[model samples]
Target chain A: MDIEVIKRYLPLFSKAFLLTVKIGWLGIALAFVLGILCAFTLYYKLPVLSTIVRFYVELFRNTPLLVQLFFIYYGLPSIGIRISAQLCGTLGLGLLGGSYMAESIRSGLEAVPAIQSESAKSLGMTKWQAFRYIIAPQAFNISVPGLMANVIFLLKETSVFSAISLMDLMFTAKDLIGLHYNTTESLFLLVLFYVLMLLPVSFAGSLIEKKVRFGMYGD
Target chain B: MEEILKVEHLHKSFENLTVLEDVSLTVNKGEVVVIVGPSGCGKSTFLRCINGLEDIQDGRVILDGQTINPPLQKGDNYRQRIGMVFQSYELFPHKTILGNIMLAPIKVQKRDKNEVRAEAEQLLEKVGLSSKKDNYPRQLSGGQKQRVAIVRALIMHPEILLFDEVTAALDPEMVREVLDVILELAKQQRTMLIVTHEMAFARAIADRIVFMDGGSIIEVSEPERFFTEPRTERAKRFLKTFEY
Candidate 1:
């Protein structure tokens, strides 16, 4: 392992790391929002929308993210619509992560007893008020820790974006290995960069979990 | 006192199973009615039907001269007028005791925060839980949770209060605290339909005691006569269970 090759690759790797972060941020945020909306639609039992959401969740959950990414990035142009690779990659991540996230949030919604709504209603709250004030907050609290942990996997999943030439961290590492004829340093740095990125997120999730967990079941 | 609530020829079912069959009762304003029956005999369902939490297949629930059922009444009226407490306490766990008490008043009633908070604090004091105002439901004991649930109901200033075995979830020692709160509220002449198996508490607070079996009211009599001289065979059989 030549220290000099690693030194030379550091600038490129750092730039790729930033790209990975940017994609992860956009994809995870979109997924979280989309997932929550799907969960709410299922929970509130919207008529046609609920059916559509269920079908969407099933379709995404059952398929491979890579296949979905390829179709978006590679398949769309053949049909006359052209989009950027990053946009396609981000959309693929959002669509894929959203299905699992919907399941997680649905479980969170179920964890709240039906009686909460009944009690809220009995107190003269409107159904919308009950949902907004009582049910949604508790459900979010129940979902936050698990969903935050999911973000780590989401970040790791960004590696798939490199397949579409998105210039993410994995692509940078692979490019360097090809150019410098060095595998050990590239792989080691790749693992180290992910660790550096994920450890703080994991720590923050655990911290939030503890804060919400306090006075949750017992003081 | 005028009639505040009346259940007429009510029947409720879940899919193929009928839980309440041809049940009817009347509650006058400022009346305390105690309903007791074996488990699964539809005691709680009766309370829920009054609050419109459960749908009825037949008949109506009249509240303040207005029909409070779906076909005639808006969902808002039943909710605003009828307050209910569950066997499980059903206090919002994520909210503080004060937040649990204040939510409906502020959000639904659109009341001023300072005024509502002051009123909530007074209710907490009334329940002897003023110190627990800032506490979450999980921070309190079973008795305290029940007390907070009571305050939550009372804060709504409901026309009628329905309690579904509020003490059933508590320890034996905790039951009295909740019953005391109910009895205190009873003294203030709040209309209440309480479903409880605590016959002693029922006899103390109830103006009328309803005995139900097989989803039907077997007897409805004043507390003293019903306990001492039950008229129906079912009531006699029911009372006989506690004799030992």
Candidate 2:
């Protein structure tokens, strides 16, 4: 356990940390938007579109994230669609997170009672207007806790991005251990790095849960 | 007098169970019709049909002389002009009382905000809920919620109002508050069709009493006669327990 070896790898860890943050941030934003769209299609029972969305969710949710990332990073090139490893990692995380988000949002939509929809209709709101105003706001509140949990899980899943040569936090740690031949110390710090990445997400998720509860159910 | 609503041979059934059968009635402009019957007699279903909330299987309903059979064509059709209040006080729980009242006028009618707000304030006062304007539905008592619902319905300035046992959800003490508001509306001669089992309420303010049973109106008469004579045997039996 050489202290100097860990100290020398600090700058590499910082660069890897930035890549990890980039992957998580971009993946979550894209996943959240895609998830909401998928949830809307599923909730409304749109013809054809709903079926395709269900298939996409099933495919991503059932398979292993590591395997999914490998397929995207390795398999795509054989099919003549070459892309950067970083882009592949992002797309993999987005698809994985989007699937879980769809389920969370669907549960949220189901939580709204039939009476609310009728009341909206009675007010002469069009179908889309009713969904946008009444159903969407309420559903967002209902699903916040679950979606926030999904976000934390997504952050951990970003670790799989290391296998695809993205130089994310885990990959940087693995390279340092290889160069320095110190598995115990490097692995311990890697675990700490991951814990640090997820701490803010978990904290922020709870804050959102609190805000959603107040907005929806009040004090 | 021009009629406000006319139902001819209205029949509705869900799956295999028939709810309403061959129901025909006419409501005159400025008239208040009170529909009373035993549970499962389809009184609420009848009210829902008039507002186009439920589709009738076999009959035509003419509202203010226009047929309500076909789904209304988009825009320029303000079937919302006919407002309804429910037994559940189905006020929008997420909104303040003022928000509930302003929703229809602003969104449906596209009325100016200040004008709608002033009108909402006046309606809330009329329903005796002016002080609770900022409270959410969950924050109010059942009686207060129903009062806001009444104000929400009336703010649309609907040509006719339908009350479906609005006081049914309230405690005995709170029922008087809701009935008093309805009585005030009756005093103003707002066209309304109310469904209730409160005989004294039906007798006190209703212009006409319609006794229904098994999805048919067996007797329709002036309040005094319907309560006193009750020509049909069913009406007579039904009135026996409700004797004041």
Candidate 2 pairs with clashing backbones: none
Q: What is the C-alpha lDDT of each candidate?
A: 0.87, 0.85
Model 2: residue A115 alpha-carbon error in angstroms: 1.7
- Look at candidate 2 and tell me the lDDT of residue B83: 77
Model 1 misplaced stretches (Cα beyond 4 Å): A1-7, A44-55, A182-185, A217-219, B71-75
lDDT tens string, model 1, B1-244?
Answer: 7999989999999999999999999999999999998889998888888888888999998888888874473554457767888888888888888888888888878899999999999999999999998888988899999889888888888898999999988999999999999999999999999999999999999999999888889899999999999999889889889887
TM-score of chain B of 2: 0.96
lDDT of 1 by residue, A112-197 (tens): 88889888888877788888888887887888877986788788898888899988889988987888768988987888788877
lDDT of 1 at B86: 85
All candidates: TM-score: 0.93, 0.91
The reply for model 2, stretches above 4 Å from the true place, is A1-8, A78-80, A181-196, B240-244
